[model samples]
Target: MNKLTPPTRLTGWGRATASGASVLPVSRGNIADAVVGAPERGALVRGLGRSYGDAAQNAGGLILRLAGLAGDAVLDTVQHTVTVGAGVSIDDLLRVTVPQGYFVPVTPGTRFVTIGGAIASDIHGKNHHGEGSFGNHVRRISLLLADGTTLEISPSQHTELFWATIGGMGLTGAIVDATISMLPIETSRCIVDTTRAHDLEHILTLMEEGDDRYRYSVAWIDLMAKGRHLGRSVLTRGDHATVEQLTGSATSSPRHYDPRVVASVPPVVPVSLINNLSVRAFNEFWFRKAPLYRTDEIHSLAGFFHPLDMVGSWNRIYGPRGFVQYQFLVPFGQEDALRHIVERFAASGAASFLAVLKRFGAGNAAPLSFPAPGWTLALDIPASFSGLGEILHELDHTVLDAGGRHYLAKDSHTTPQAISRGYPRLAEWQDVRNRSDPTGVWRSDLGRRLGLIA
Candidate 1:
């Protein structure tokens, strides 16, 4: 066992808030010991720390860094399934599986997330309309309970605990490993279609009409545009490219998979670099650069699904104060509410450079899961912006009133009242959690702040 590191300052990917905790790196063999000997502040498992908010932080507590628990991925090609360590990142898993003609059934925008993080947050992706969130593909999970007991949980066994742990945000317990179903593919490329929507209505209509035709779809909206151009967007939709679609070297090596980070942001930058004026200009250029109508463009898997991954430490561009990723989902019928929220962001002069919109299909049984059959929009706003908190709080009410909810993975400021209203299954989730961890051994900053754990 490795010695525990001294109390260190840690923050989420957003880097807006900071907390200090003693980080203990533990392997599967020693995880039990660490949990059993945890301090009064309790312990929480942490993965790659990609959550945009405090979901993984445990102030004054013991942080179990699971990276040391990584093990080789066991692939069962016959069953199209893989059992990977909780610490294994999606990027690492893809490096091995993509060449084997298989891919993660569901992947978020960034491939740096760990398997444990994926299960804890029930991450969704562009293909959610077709395959649902990561939890849908999960076959089994090895969880370490607060009582230092390790249990193998599946949908049919320990069913309630399994579902609650899906989006339980690591409060259920420390995920040790997981067996997941993989999606087979002929190649590592995607056959993509692109179109530019003139306004909010046009884009929503286009997505509603044709999104089902593609396996993956997403729209990049220009939140800075107002009036006639309000919510103008570039819609890109696609699926894994077939072998026949590949040519030359790609045809012979159709399963080739390699993702590289082309650039890294400086350690520090001036907040002024991301002001409304600069972001608006960038958004305009970005929108104009997309083809009015393009079809069947072959793109690498990384290029298509994780563009931001191409730039390492890209969040540094947001400067010292970092940025907030506010993502909310409204049911299919709440188009008016979606439009109202977009209009509010446009009118607020918020400097949001990465604004994305996607449609989610039916949600799974995870009580805290963010997706539903609705329209979901995610925006990256500079945290230094004045009145940004107020703007988001108001948006929260609008979303809740529309029968929608915010993604806990990206939330830092949403009130507990809003959470209770959004997730009606909270009581059910809490019941399962309490039974599983009556002593409250599993805890996090998010859990305490939101009253997720009693």
Candidate 2:
């Protein structure tokens, strides 16, 4: 008789954990054969589990991790496409693609993410201002269904399933392989520019003006700013640096250089490290250290896209209890209301380490997908704050009244009423999902908590 091993917990960027009902690795041929024909009542596909929320957790059912599936991660430079197993990491993608002068069309702040997780979250990037999102560049995806059937889907073929699966967070089916377009760049460097905004107005003005001009655009918000200067930020914009721009710098070819990496996280980082005094000082240093304005031609891809990727296990900095990621979007016309939420955070005395602001264009084709034409903000806070959920719940109502919505990725506290008002397309998206997953083989805590499906 052989001893049995439990399935491992699926975790990505945010450091949280859940137990699997049972653990099974996908590569084992014995397991693959057994899984496909089960007609599962609740099965979910998980890749890197990099999603900021519980979209990847199946609660009490099957959590199919797509990474272990045996296959080659083949990239076709001629067609500017790559076919990777669902488990392929973005860090690996750069190793192979950067040398070939191509890059993933969209990437989040970290590179530990898997291909399946990226598709599951339909992750966006600094280029979202110009590229829309990662899903927009996907040409096709191959899904292994619950009943041993495989289908190749795209925008034109199996369009409903295609759209649903884009941001479906693996609920639709298991993604085995996907063909996506790659962006051609002059070099692996970005022409970096930073302009410190005195307040929220300055931040939005710059974003509204030049965000369209850059392939990568992001703003860092100093959430602790109070009084009339609340929500102050520094806007950074960039595009692939040209050879001519890098001429005067230390490195001629940015591609030939290596970046300094944080190979490991500190064994322990106290929650007090991110407190108001510390974050306030850090923000002040960031604001003052930045020049009024300057252009840097030499920037590495890792530094530009996944600065934190180099720091492995940085999430532990939030301490043992883990943390919560709050991502919300406010419509263009409701800028004042958005400011109100930021102001409320100031009054609440919460310390959020990472706060990001991005301006989104037209929403993507995924009905259940998060991005729309609005300004989106993301924040990471220690989960220990007893009043945190209550404050967030109030912000949820504020967001809804402002005609805005929260991102399903970084959400955990939003209520059902807010979810309904925030996402008007929920019913239609639900109908389509119910039709596809008639057996409800796919369900996550985010879905049930938000009343996405009964």
Most lDDT-accurate candidate = 1
RMSD of 2: 2.8
Q: 50-136 in candidate 2: lDDT tens per residue?
A: 776677776655665555422366777788888777777777777767766777899889877777778877888787778887889
Clash pairs, candidate 2, are: 7-23, 43-441
Q: What is the C-alpha RMSD of each candidate to the true structure, in Å?
A: 1.5, 2.8
Prediction-by-prediction clash tally: 0, 2
Model 2: what TM-score?
0.92
Taken over the whole model, the C-alpha lDDT of each candidate is 0.91, 0.75
TM-score of each: 0.98, 0.92
For candidate 1, the TM-score is: 0.98
1-454 per-residue lDDT for model 1 (tens digits)? 3255678898999988789989988788889999988887889999998999898899989999886322388999999999999989999999999999999999999999999999999999999998899999999999999989999999998999999999999988999999999999999999999999999999999999999999999999999999999999999999999999987778878998888999988777766468887898899899999999999999999999999999998888888898899999999999999999999999998899889999999999888888899999999998888999998899899999999998999988888888889999999999999999888888898887877776
